[model samples]
Target chain A: MTAHTSSSSSLGLISSATAISQGAEAKVYYASLHPAPSPASTTETVDVLIKHRFHKGYRHPSLDNSLTKSRVAGEARALIRCLRCGVHVPGIRMVDAAEGVLALEWIDGKSVRFLLGGGAEGEEEEAADSEDSDVAEAAAQEDDTDPLSEYGATQDELMAMVGAEIAKMHRGDVVHGDLTTSNMMLRHPRSEKGLQLVLIDFGLAYTSTLVEDKAVDLYVLERAFASTHPASEPLFASVLRAYQAGMGREWTAISKRLDDVRLRGRKRSMVG
Target chain B: METYHYPSFPADASHVHIALFKNVSNAAELRSRIVRASLLEGSEGDLEREAVNFAFIDARLICSRVHLQTAIYQAVLAHAQGALRTKTVHSEILWTLNPSNNISEAIRRYGVSDTTAFLIVVRISTANDANVLANMQAVVSGELSRFSLEGITDWASVKKYYKLNSEPALKIQGITLVQERKIIDEIVTSTVAMKSVMT
Candidate 1:
């Protein structure tokens, strides 16, 4: 981890940004997009969450550059598509495809997974490398406090938001390849935008209008819930109900396709 | 006038010295001067070019600071990589802001024109910003004002240029004026940020 940090500091934005989490695909950091306003106004700085997809040593440099460039482009494209569709995703702040960096509007809030008692991301993976941050996180997590209550929202409300947002994305013909609770965030209630559910991390997202593709999206999130949260069936039930309402007339075909997807799992049955 | 130093950028192109000029009386003259500077030759050429090196942008089409900064960031990034499509980093910002890849079209639409009343002059410099402000003022004649896009932005021109005329995001009937502008700013800013990859 120290080695990664040292090498990454060469990139201006990533070097200045504070690392938040590290996944296999990219490293996430918090950074401001523009310079701070004059101190007289005392206005808060507008921040962005930068996702840097670092270069791989094993791959050829030429191959690495093209792959990184395309992925950065693809993710930015997906995000803009979702934004145009009115999905509550973070706005794109900047894109440096050459450096494989994407900066998004920094969402001020907690992830749905953490709010629901699933540990914050990278807990086990980061424990060894980042003991200080782990300790700080542990201290922040007080006992007997239901984090979700602080957001002034019920479980049903969050589920509804999640479902509705996915419906909106599907309607836009963009499939969020990775739709886990960790990828969903609820804005702090006191923030300017107020309480809102935000879907994020569009790394694997792609454009597809197929009902089967959309159904598989729901299926992935469903499986994510089952693995991460206990008694998640009821929670996902509310999600589905809200999703059905949002889907409207399109719900019939998707729901039918979803059943087939459930029986055979995410992939469709291949026939000769 | 606002001076922003980007530590992320190298020293040569790190400092972004921007001044918003209102009541610009030299729009036509400045345009010709830039064209003349480009065609200049020898020692006289270098000095004349340096005098008017700042980016003289049409403030009407700019929806917000983010809209402008996104273009500047991409321009500087291209410069750093030695892949700038335009002659200099200053002109590349105009190219980045434009939807199409045409260099002349970008300058014609976003750069200084005859009737440009509000002008934004940008100079990417080293940390040593001595005389940079003076150089900007010497090139363009206008009253310096605080940066703000309120009432200055021509939403119609921005919408037309970015091809948002029929976009569903803006076409929804009865969308409030503020909501419309916010949507435009977001789309325009993002478009500039991803212009390089955008086909």
Candidate 2:
């Protein structure tokens, strides 16, 4: 009953928010905590990203509710663990787990995928607008001069940040079940820590102390890079190098396991 | 004093009033009064309760304005949905700040103590009554200052309460004290935000 009330309230909030993306399991929205400020005021409104895991029609009603609740809780927990480990993940702003709504701090820069020229198909049109006229107009209207340059990081530097952040998460025994360029973001140059890489989308993440799990995490990212980016081998190698440096002595075992994982895929054989 | 409106909540419960009180010399008296008010009955008790209706948080434990705001927001959310774990939204704010689920422990650590010097008081209401600020000032015997967060945080106590000394986020190399505190503040505020769902 409480879950029902909370879920309906969360749905109401989402209904009012501007939908940013719609996926199979959840929908993302751009939202704000504070009301819109006056036109003349220079104060900044707090922006948030709301991730709502809506009800699944395929599953039974009760089963779907429980699954959504648990998944939302799990994701929030993994993110908190990552933050404690110094991993660059979006900070949570609000969570209604029973309602399957999680609000997070809105990172104000482009995704690594977009910056690396592997933007999603839907974003291609917006990404291609490199004309100086519109850019100048936008620059005059807003603070950001150019969205792409806001990160101020080279491709190699971005990769290194990605690898180092992942290593930190793995060292804390958290496995990001999904890791891809699309899930990593580079902070705007004007942010507190300019040009920092932030990992996002912990909906599939979980905690595991096993070396196998850690290796598999890295392998997933490697595969993602190889598929998404052109000439990704050297880029991934640099990522591993930074990861190795971050992990130090712990890297040796995970590196060997990763090599084996790369050969055998994500699944471990159970035939033995 | 600052006010926030939550569009998702009912109008009666949407308005939030927050004020910071520094140099609080009557903390011990306020604590005792609150305890006494809890045991009162009928109109007399109602009057006593009205006097100390705000969440009197120990400001020293708060990392930043955002940290306090996060707890207040979550508490208000729980209240709006009829899912409050504690008796009232004011107490719930304190409950959400503690890492553990123990209600009394949360109050003991985050609630105003006899030795409390700095305090952050918050009230969640439906109406933006003109008397709210005056009422708060009447109850608290401390100086009301601008709600600026700088220089008000007790980082040492915060790290102790959150157990951040062993956290890897603080152990990273090349992180200055200011940067480390920023990370800690973000993490702590985030933890409070999601405390309701934390298992």
Question: TM-score of model 1 relative to the true fold?
Answer: 0.91
In the range B1-199, model 2's lDDT, one tens digit per residue, is 7777666776666777888898998999999999999999999999999889989999888987678878987887788777899999999999999999999999999999999888888888876566888988887899997776678788988888888999988987788888988998998999999898887
Candidate 1 i-RMS: 3.5
Residue A125's lDDT in candidate 1: 65
Model 1: per-residue Cα lDDT over A1-272, one tens digit each: 22333333237677777998777778889888777543223254668888998888788888888999899999889888877777778878777777788888888899999888887876656666898977876776756578888998998999998888888888889999999999999999897556879999888999998998999999999999999999999999999999999889999999998888889998766886
TM-score of each: 0.91, 0.91
Instruction: Write down the lDDT of every candidate, Cα atoms only.
Output: 0.85, 0.84
Top of the candidates by lDDT: 1
lDDT of 1 at B155: 97
Model 1 C-alpha lDDT per residue in residues B63-131, reported as the tens digit of each score? 988888889888888887777999999999999989999999999999999999999999998987799
Model 2, C-alpha of A151: deviation from truth (Å): 3.0
Error of 1 at B133 (Å): 1.6
Candidate 2 falls in which docking quality class?
medium
Per-model chain B TM-scores are 0.98, 0.96
